[model samples]
Target: MREIIVLSGKGGAGKTSVTAAFAALARDTVLCDLDVDAPDMHILLEPTGTRREPFVSGHLASIRAEACDGCGECAARCRFGAVTRTPDGRYAIVPGHCEGCKTCVVLCPRQAIDFTPRTCGWSAVSDTRFGPLVHARLDPGAENSGRLVALLRGKAKALAKARGLDMILCDGAPGIACPVVSSISGATLAVLVTEPTPSGSHDLTRVAKLCDHFRLPTAVIINKADLNPDEARRIEDFCADTGRPVLGRLPYSPDVVRAMTARLTLPEYGGPLAEAAAELWQAVVTLAAASRPQLQPL
Candidate 1:
């Protein structure tokens, strides 16, 4: 199955809206929202969750107070400074500060420190107005988001395989960080949704470099291209000089926001903006197909 991930170098680049529009148009595809940190695709898809699974990315070690003899070795050995001295002269492990390292468990002279798994987040398989969506919600102030993203991708791939879907359309997170890296790692193609501004140019360069790091084929779609023609031209020129394809340039339209406010995708609006979104979808699908290795006729 082909996995096409929509990403951006920064937030507010209209990645989620475009991904939702593509999901609305694509046939036989599993829609995935890998932005666990701030997943907003559900806002448009209006998914009714059918299956929920706990996503435990890692462990959070804790000290058993009842078993502790107050050796304080674990506290002293913890390099993360996760251990704190309580007012009663006891060393306590902070859940937020714990890095899940087992060093404290081994170094504790009292052998009171035990590692326990913490719930980092949860992923869900939901039935949306469009189709089945694989999405997640990360706990606030949680770490290991990259691992969580990878887990969500795996679940989406599994759902696609089980249903014999042709593709997995993923609404990826913004920026060139770990979560974004995990989201695009094995994607067949990345559709980069960008805007026209100085920050847009800077972030685009960073995100493009990240895509290149994975050697993934990438296409650009400049949202609000008409807002700043000069900046848009610069972005286009950069893509041209770098040999990256610009799939479509969508003009700024208030209709997009209106549709989003109504919790609907652009295509669902069935207007001129919808037509533009449809055209963009076609280009994205064609690019994804072209990038795939063609089978040789026997």
Candidate 2:
């Protein structure tokens, strides 16, 4: 199956907006929102009939009050300050402060600390107006975001296969971090949505290099290209130098905000940006279907 991932070098680059438009336009596809830390696609797609399950990763330590002997050994051995003395002068493991290092669990003399699986977040399969959506929500301050992303992608792939779908469209997280790394691995194509600004240009370069590191084919779509003509040209020059395709440019329009406020995809709202999004989606499909070397994870 062909998998197209929409990403941005930084936040507020309109990546999710473009992805939602593609969702409205594409067919026979499974939609995936890989930005578990801050998922907002449901706001536009309005997913329903969700099937959710807890995401358990790593472990957290809690003091068993019954078995505790008020020994300060666990508190002294914890380097993260997760173990602290409560008001009753008894040592306790602070859930938020615990880093799951198992230091306290291993070092406790009384063996009062209980190490159990942590419910970091949850994953879901839901129905949207367009198609099936496999999304997730990571708890605030939770770790293992990359793992959650991979798990969600696996579910999307499986759902697509079961439904005899041919495509999987993913909305990836911003920045070249662990979650982005997980999102791009084994992707058929990476569509980068960027804006015309100094930070946008710089971050685009960083994320593009990250795609290159994995030997992934990439394309660029400059959002609000008219805002700064010079910076847009600079971005185009960079894309040319790097041998990445510039699919299309979307002009600045107030209707984009209006459509967002109405909780509608650009295409559903209908505007100049919607037309541009349609054209970009076509380019992405063509590129994704083109013959290329098999992608192997590094």
Candidate 3:
């Protein structure tokens, strides 16, 4: 099966919006929202009957009040100040402040600290009009986003295999971080959506270099090309210099915002933007085939 990942170097580059449009355009596809930390694809897709499961990361420390000696030992050992004396004179572990390092657990003289599997967040599978979507949410200030992204990708791939679909369309997180790495791993291609700004240009190069490091076939699409023609051309120049094709340039329009505000993809609204999306998707399909001639069917 061929997997296509939609990624961006920064947030608000319209990555998820483009992915939502692609979902509406693609046929026989399994969808995945890999932006676990701040996922919003479901807002447009409107998924239902999602099955949730705990995502266990590292262990969290909890003080067993009954076994505590009230010696202030745990509080003194915690570098994060997670251990604190309660109003009732009992030592307590603040769940958020605790880094789950277990240093206090090991240092406690009373053996009152308990280290248990921490529920970092949850992953879920839901059915949308397009197809089965594998998505996740990371708890506030939680860690291991890369691991959760990997899990979500696996679930999406499995669902694609089960449903006999030929493609997996993933909406990846912003930036070239661990989460993006996990999202792009073993993918057939990476579609980068970028805006026309100095910051966008800089981040595009950074993310492109990362894709190069992983030997991923990458392409670019400039959104809101009308806002800044110079930077848009600069983006094209960068793509040309790196030999990555500029798939399409979508014009700036209020229609996009109107469509989004109504919880719909541009393609579903049947406008100039939709036409551009169709052209972009067609180019993507052609390139994917050219990039991997013998790609297996799902």
Candidate 4:
């Protein structure tokens, strides 16, 4: 199976929306949202049959109030300074602040601290119109989001393989962050979505470099290309210099916003935006066909 990821340099670059449009247009594909930290792809896909399970990451620290004895000992030992005094004057461990290093747990003179596996968030397998969708939600302040991204990707691949699906369409997290790296690990093709903005141009360059580091085939999609003609030209020039093609461009349109407000895709919105999205999807498919042989799992 071929896995293609839709990524952006930063948030609000229209990565997920473009991904949703692709999902709507692509045939025989499984959907994945690897943006575990801020997953919103399901909003457009409208996933159903969701089965959620806890995603346990590193350990968390808990304090036994009775055993703490208002001890300054645990507080002093905590490197993260997670141990805090409660209103009741007992020592407590802040779940958000604690790094779960277990140093306080190991050194507590009163044996007040407890270390347990952290249920960082929940991962869900769901059904979307495109196919099975693998997605996740991480708790606020949770660490190890890279693992969560990998987990969802693995799940999506497994689902695709089980059903003999041809493609796995993944909506990736914004920026060249840890989760974004994890999202591209096994992708067959990487599509970097950008807008006609200087920041967009800069970020696209950064992400394109990252794709090169992974030796992955990459393409570019310029959204709202007409909004800034000069930046669009710069982006296209950069892509040409880097040997990554600017496969397609979409002009600025308020109908995308209308579709978003109505919880539908561009095609469902039924207009020029949908037609353009179809053309973009064709370009992605053509690129994927040419690059499929290079799509080895990393």
Candidate 5:
């Protein structure tokens, strides 16, 4: 399957909306929302989750008071300084501060430390009007986003393969962080969605650098391209200079907001915005087909 990740170096660049539009156009594809921290694809796709499972990663350490001798060895050995004296004259492990290094468990004279599974979040498989949707939800203030992203991508790919699908449309998280790195890994193509603003241009360059580092084929889609024609020219020039293709440029339209209020894809909204989004989807399909392996069946 061809995995296409739509990403941006910053949030609110219309990346997810573009991904949803592409998903609406694909013939045989699975939609995956890899934005575990703030997944909104489900809102547009209206997916009904059929399966949900707890995702546990790493471990949280707790002290067994009954076994504690209060020798203060665990406190001294803990590098994270998670162990602290309690009002009852005992050392306690703070869940938020503990790094779960297991050093306290091993060095404690009384062997009072116990490691427990930490619930990071939940992953789900859902059925949407567009297609099979694989998405995840992260626990508030949870860590392990990179690992969760990998897991979500793997599930999406596996579902696509099982159903004999040809494409995996992923709405990747924003920024060049760990989650973004996981999103780009094994991607057949990376579509950088940007706007025509100074901040947009800056972040677009950052995302482009990340794609270059991974040697992934990349294309740029400029949303609100008319907002700043001068900046648009600069974006086009930058792409030309760097040998990256400008897939499509979409104009600023309030219809997109209306579509969002209706909880529908841009193409399904049926207006000037829908027409513009259709043109963008055509470009995307052309690129995806071009990037497909020659030996692979279309």
Candidate 6:
């Protein structure tokens, strides 16, 4: 199956908006929101009949107070300062402070610690008007966001295969962090959405380098290209140097905000911005089809 991931080096670059527009235009596709930490595609898609399950990963150490000898060995050995003495002089593991490193669990003289899997978040399979969407939510301050992203992608792939779908459109997280790395690994194409600003130009280079490191074919879309012609030209020059195609240049339009406020995809709203999005999607599909051997899982 062909998988196309939409990403941005920083947030508010219109990444999700573009992804939602692609969802409205693409056919025989499974939609995936890989921004586990902060997913907003559902706001536009308004999914229903979601099948959700707890996402369990990593481990948390809990002290069995009844089995403790009050030696305070675990407390002294924990580097994260997760262990503390209770009011009655008993040692306890602070749930929020614990790093789950298992150092306390291993050093407990009384063998009072119990290490159990942690429920970090939830994953779901839901039905949208366009197709099936596989998305997830990572608990605030939770670790292993990269793992959750991989798990959601696996579910999306399985669902697509079962339904005989040929494409998977993923809305990836911003930045070149672990979650973004997980989102693009083993994908068919990576489409980067960026704006015309100094930070946008800088971050676009960073994310483009990341895709290059993985040998993933990438294309660029300059959102609000008219806002700063010089910076937009700089971004285009960078893309030219890196051999990445500039798919489309979208002008700044308040209609985009109006469409989003109405909770509708650009194509569904129907305007100049929507027309540009449709042309961009066409370029993306053409490039994705011609792109060579997909990046193998890393």
Best by TM-score: 2
Candidate 3 local accuracy as lDDT? 0.89
Q: Cα lDDT of model 2 overall? A: 0.92
lDDT of 1 by residue, 1-298 (tens): 7999998899998899889999999999999998989999988888885698998877888877788777789878889999998777778898888888889988888788888788988989999888899888899989888998898888888888888888999998888888899988878998899999999888988988888878788889999999999999999988887778898898998898799888888998878879988998898888888855332221
Report RMSD (Å) for each prediction in the order shown.
3.8, 2.2, 3.5, 2.8, 3.7, 2.6
lDDT, candidate 5, 1-298, per-residue tens = 6888999889999999899988887778988899999999988998875699899998888999878878899889888889999887888998888877889888877778898999889999999888999999998878999999999988998998899998999999999999999889778888899999999999999988888877777889999999999999999999887878898788998988999999999888887877777887777777876853222111
Count of steric clashes across candidates, in order: 0, 0, 0, 0, 0, 0
Write down the worst ten-residue block by lDDT for model 6.
289-298
lDDT of 4 by residue, 263-285 (tens): 99888888998998999899888
Better of 5 and 6 by lDDT: 6
Q: Candidate 2's residue-wise lDDT over 87-188, tens digit each?
A: 887888888999999988888888888999999999999999999999999999999999999999999999999999999999999999999999998998
Question: Model 6 scores what on Cα lDDT?
Answer: 0.93
How do the predictions measure up, each by TM-score?
0.93, 0.97, 0.96, 0.94, 0.93, 0.96
Query: Whole-model Cα lDDT per candidate?
Result: 0.87, 0.92, 0.89, 0.87, 0.87, 0.93
Q: Per-residue lDDT for 1-298 in model 3, tens only? A: 9999998899989899899999999999999999999999999999998999999999999998899878898888788988889887889999999999888888888888899999999999999998889999999999999999999988888888888999999999999888998887678999999999998898888888887777778889999989999999999988877788899999888988899899999998878899999999999988877754321111
Q: Give per-residue CA lDDT, model 6, range 227-262, as digits (tens).
A: 999999999988877788899899999989999999
TM-score of predicted structure 4 = 0.94
Candidate 5 clashes between residue pairs 3 or more apart in a chain or in different chains: none
Q: Which of the two, 2 or 3, has more lDDT?
A: 2
Alpha carbon deviation, residue 212, candidate 4 (Å):
0.6
